[model samples]
Target: MDAVPLLRISRPHRLSEEVGAVLEKHIRSGEFGPGEKLPAEARLAEQFAVSRAVVREAIARLKADGLLESRQGSGVYVAQCLGAGVFRMAAGVRGEAHPIEDIFELRLIIEVAAAERAALRRTPADVEAIEAALARMDEAVALSADGVRADDDFHCAIASASGNPLIGRFVAFVSHEFSASRAPTWSREGIVRGLAGAAQDEHRAVHAAIVAGDPAAARRAARQHLLRAARRLGVVLAAPPGARGEDMDEETS
Candidate 1:
């Protein structure tokens, strides 16, 4: 009989990361179809030869990355395919020195429209989700500097409430972009505290407008929020080289 060689696999210190990688591979390979429910956690743990805690952590990470979704009393399912626009924004954040002004302008245009639509289309559940996100933002602000995450969550929730999956996906995409750019800025304690306060106020205004179903107010609030974000990035609004006034107005408008 011929001898079979044993394969050795490297063990990662973090079990969750290892599990996440395995699950991610399956997702990318299309082994799990879009919107397909994953097996129960216990079964997944057994199949992966890991603990349920590790499996749960892996699921949570994937969910954060907009790759998986969970339904109450149901199970985890693969997320729908995110459009190219969302992926393009996410792909642009790879150690490149992004122009903060340009990024803020893009965010302003997309998010304001998203807020307006959300105001017009949001359901009662969407309103509750936004309110919950607002509460989290307040909690994060009270707890201090790291509260910017809650602010991000609040905005992302509004994007999701727009009832347009692509909008939600784009929000998730740009979030990573903004985070990468702001990492240096947020490192300063003073900057963090100041931005946290500003974010809370902006989020409150947006939430109020959305709850009231006032699309115009929602758009204004969202636009103002992005403008504030641009200011924080120290970006000056200047005409693009060789562009005429009419051209600039047309582009921005």
Candidate 2:
């Protein structure tokens, strides 16, 4: 078999991401098989000539992406099926070849419905999780892009709150696709500078609608939020028949 090329890390920046790229390439290239245990953290650190923290971060990211799993007191092994489809989508975003707007469109369809359902179906535990995620989002917003994990957690909690296992799993599957793509689009610099506070206010609307068990309100808020995101990303809206530029503006407005 041909050798899999490794990513060359010339500059010492984001060692964890670089490490993840290297390991992901190897895994995709079949250098590592599913259910196979990864080398110990110390060995991986030595191989990459970086500290264990870097390796740990890389592994954490992979685990989050569902590419790997770890059992306490055991070892980290590749997850069954390895979720190559999700990985490819994430890789496309990372390469900047994927259209971020299109992904947002897909997210709009999935999340709006999910939010509506969650509002109707959420149990006490689901409400608690959603509130916790909202708190995290508030904290992240105050801190700017530093709140990526919290923002992500909020969405995941929403998925779970929907009370549909399939929906939650699907959302979790595509969650990482927006990590790099949507983060820059919704961060403090992005939202505050671009939307002039509309973005934050829109999120609040969605949260409130969900909490109130108002499905229609939730759907509307979710659609408006994603539409704003699509506009910010420069996505061209496909106008319906007899719909002019003014109509499009009115619809979005």
lDDT of all predictions, in order shown?
A: 0.73, 0.74
lDDT of each residue in 1-253, candidate 2, tens digit only: 9999999979766989999989987875558877789999999999999999999999999888778889799999887545534545634456554667567757877888888998898888777777786676665566554555555656767778899978876776667665555677556677567442455676778788888999988877877777776676676445457855644673556
**Across residues 1-253, which tens digit of lDDT does each residue of candidate 1 receive?**
9999989989756989888888877885669877899899999999989899999999998887767888899999987642212354433666465466667767766888999999998989778878887787577556554544555656677888899987876776666565544453344463455775676688789989998999989987887676666666666455458865653563455
How much does candidate 1 score in TM-score?
A: 0.58
* Best candidate, lDDT: 2
Alpha-carbon RMSD to native, per candidate? 13.1, 14.0
Supply candidate 1's per-residue lDDT for 203: 79
TM-score of 2: 0.60
lDDT of 2: 0.74
